[model samples]
Target chain A: AVAAPAIAQSAPTIKWRLASSFPKSLDTIFAAAEVVAQHVKAATGGKFDIQIFAAGELVPGLGVLDAVKDGTVECCHTAGYYFIGKDPTFAFDAAIPFGLNSRQQNAWLWEGGGMELLRDFFKDYNIHNIPCGNTGTQMGGWYRKELKTLADLKGLKMRIGGLGGPVLARLGVVPQQIAAGDIYPALEKGTIDAVEWVGPYDDEKLGFNKVAKYYYYPGFWEGSAQLSLYINQKKFQELPKEYQQILEDACAYAHLEMQARYDIKNVNALRRLAAAGTQLRAFSKEVMSAANKEAFAMYDEYSAKNPKWKKIYEPWKKFRDDELLWFGVAEKSFDDFVHSTRGGKR
Target chain B: AVAAPAIAQSAPTIKWRLASSFPKSLDTIFAAAEVVAQHVKAATGGKFDIQIFAAGELVPGLGVLDAVKDGTVECCHTAGYYFIGKDPTFAFDAAIPFGLNSRQQNAWLWEGGGMELLRDFFKDYNIHNIPCGNTGTQMGGWYRKELKTLADLKGLKMRIGGLGGPVLARLGVVPQQIAAGDIYPALEKGTIDAVEWVGPYDDEKLGFNKVAKYYYYPGFWEGSAQLSLYINQKKFQELPKEYQQILEDACAYAHLEMQARYDIKNVNALRRLAAAGTQLRAFSKEVMSAANKEAFAMYDEYSAKNPKWKKIYEPWKKFRDDELLWFGVAEKSFDDFVHSTRGGKR
Candidate 1:
């Protein structure tokens, strides 16, 4: 018995199972987990192996956080905001309406004291969180009809992700929760008037364009959605420090790779969708303005009542504001000019 | 006999030297190399160790690339663009005048076929490149006086980086390549009219504010500067696969960390500089517009002359144009709104 522990200290063999809140068909999101697993295994010369299980294999997709918290699996890949029902504070780990974008989120988590705050918050759930990937600002969704004004949203039934639903509901839209497999059919048969998925790459995969002709710009409810790896705290603590560090760097590699995959794939997919006669539309200023107001009001209400929400929200808000101001300066000016130069012509 | 290679495959101790182009004083930039070294060592259970030598200890800052190319050191950390004197194509590996921003560059390199192109290009120099870090969009420079129009740029002597100088020279500016330590004295003594380092964090550390009254926004010359680790190709090929993957992941980890460090540190430093009476100014429309035109023209000239530059530039330009269009839609709208909501009061 003692020899096993001693041998492990040198070159121990360990196996871990990773549950993912996505199906294998959504390769970019699902492959991020595989990226982490492959790098970890390759870096350790196959001493450490992590097997990935897509959603519904080990537990339901929405059940990942609880599964990790209970040590049902060693870890899980998921969007933290999916568990907002348990506590709204979960959104801080993922995305909040009008919050930081993908790059800014990376800055906050890696350097601006976010990881420490999040790590402390996560302690209560017996989970150690590591960022895995981000879906840059998302498309609003696919709609059956055009959105012309704030009134156009009233009573419109749409299938959307969890955290964003409540915000839309406040604008008189009936936000429906539909399974990933069912979203396409729901939109096709007019069971739902609209559906919001990841973006051009994933949305095209789901054939949302086939069912709904109007594809909207900017999923305002989620400026940027971050995905995370939730490791069981006790299991993570018991690893050799070297293995722990290896696992972390592996996640960082996957985190970078996932966004890269999306950026390239989405570019190609958007072109195809456009050629196939998909109508791209922007949300009216009236709608975006109203929704932004409602979203902030909701956050204020939560801050007034929830201590945990207030603690993270205060600093997170400050970081977001500062980043916005800074980015608005150089980054915006350069990008605006370049973008305005259509076709790369001077 | 030949046990060294055999033992190295199974935890044999191996040590290598890393020459960093930056001194230890610039903690964020220099610390990126340390992050890579520390992570690799811990991941390999201390079996693989890398010792870092600051600039001038092993080689001059600008000499690190040639040092790696000639196997003087196992590897070195430096900006690829620093060697543009050898070939302008080196700028693609780092930054070009009005090139892709930090996030866009990451997307292009990791997913948009950029790494392959650059890797092939580096093979000619007996080097294998790994991206190490990035300084997001930089501030233009610390200006002794405000820029009123395009005419003011004529005959202005400014200390700038290597790659951006050519484009500026075409705009009637006399570009000077001054050593980092001497930049402050040169600016203070009125030998140079302006100086562009990194951003506020690094600029403030060098005390640019005391000498230059007016600071400027949007360093158009180098929209984003990327740093890389250049490994001696033959030495890199000799490493075990496990060690190789460990090294790659470590570089990515440091790459992400460096940008995050800059983002947070720059924000705080900008605030401090403003309170201390530093005046932040933007490059006038006339200056930015004229510079933009000349920059693209210079790129066209290089494309017509250098086959290597044309090979990478064509695809890179397309990817850049597509990225600009996409970012302009959702990201720009959301950020513009939130940033305009000054003081987070809205």
Candidate 2:
């Protein structure tokens, strides 16, 4: 037995193609996929290589999931909710109306049994999902007119995306799922009354503040809009375990990196936006309350029809309730007192 | 009318002391203060300078808020929940058990009326708060014994911190709020049966996994643990508006950078931990359910007694509920399927 020497096995080289749903112009979101590619190549010493394509370069911006599912692309960087038209459940993989904020979403995905559930769902689509990045609770949108009440939503044509679009539609919003590139034009030309983008940094770069004066807060539809890496199931399985681990690590890195970029850039952009006379407004109580009601009603209807929704919803809801109860006392009280005070300057 | 040529006023040179809750050994959290200092100096061309002190250098690690409030330090870099003993509400500012994960916290703080509410809270403490960094949903902790059921938690003495310590205590586990430096010693000496530090990256550095064989998942309490920059309000007002804006931008930059470091570092450390025979375990359902019940009862009792808690809890709870209802349908459905499928390899 000692006479036989074990041969060291080298990992097989893997080449992957990642098509991003976002345009190259949107650096933070698009760069997330690039970050993953760079990390994978470096971590594996180039044993694994991923070629990334911007939206419309390889396929339509919204066609990424399907492209990955059909093996047209090995992977994709996209918002899971974008494919809600195919199955409403897809929204959890990305962003949902009044869903978990970025942190909560990350918690749900990474820790709160969310990752397992999502992986199972993606199996049906022949894809595996990893949260790549998140736009921390987005702004409501860039509005031509300030929304003062729930009535402001009625008949309003807005450029939005994912499950939120349909939820908004319930509030009498004429939801238009426009590509990123098309949004500015739509708002500029008055084709849409409003547009909800990531936040101030992206909004400033897009020059939406110039076209729309009123920028609303609490992107309730997307408390945290997560961007995901969807890989073809077969392609994922073919890779060596180390390569698989590297991809996962890279995606996680990209996930945090994207948020950091947004946080840093948003502050400066917000100052600039404010300087440029962008009117920042919180969503009116009437509007937020109405949207909240519609959002819940929609969920009840979906859960009744969708067993998948019900299965996870039960546990998830219970966890969320418990979380809220604790936060209400400890988290809320301290924040209230400290945030209200005025003191000496640094 | 041409405004009379106004003389450009030179900005005042300012120096500040920042007391950090974390030791320098934890580079990511500790480095946030340094990053903010660097950014402020660079942005203001060194006219504004900040000196950062690690835990116990200026004051005890946990006394940062008081130091900032009493003007002992010009600023502090610490989690809000560290001071929850003063008021449970502080947990919301930092992290609450089962609260908003990192992204959701950011949403609440930055967009969802959280900042305003928190700022109101901070006013009492004489601090101006800006989020400096975030640890996206943290790990449950490192344990000496495998947690297979609720029984494992009973009588377990764990070195944990923040709001989680109390929630864990309610689960029949003895929770010890130990400082970062003391965690290793406590675990090694049998003074604590287990320790829940950050994720594997920090855990490996601290060598906790070396002693604790069982590593758990889903830190229910700290979905997203936030590190904040608490500035002396009076000192903040003294800075020029441009400098103030620069400081805010710097905090935002650090916030993103810290998370990036953690996300990249955690996986490798996790792999190393696994290789080193650290058993990974999920918190048992019974334990989780029991903790949830205790967490809620604690909150209801506190809400009834604490006015500050009641005021904010009402809104925060409502918002969280509404958010969950919407996410339950689309997000939960997709995640349940995807996560259960294939270890989310894709």
**Residue A128 of model 1, lDDT score:** 98
lDDT of 1 by residue, B63-124 (tens): 99888989999999999888999999999888998899988899999999999999999999
lDDT of each residue in A25-83, candidate 2, tens digit only: 88878888998887666544455679999889999888988899999999999988778
Docking class of 1: acceptable
| Alpha carbon lDDT at A165, candidate 2 | 83
Give the candidate number with the greatest DockQ: 1
Please report the candidate that would top lDDT against the real structure: 1
Q: What is the C-alpha RMSD of each candidate to the true structure, in Å?
A: 3.3, 16.7
**Model 2 regions more than 4 Å off:** A1-346, B1-8, B329-346
Residue A62 alpha-carbon offset, candidate 2, angstroms: 16
Write one digit per residue (lDDT tens) for candidate 2, span B35-153: 88876665444556798998999998888899899988889999988888899888778777766656556656654577888889889999999888887667788887787778778
Error of 2 at A284 (Å): 36
Least lDDT summed over 10 consecutive residues: which range in candidate 1 chain B?
A: B1-10
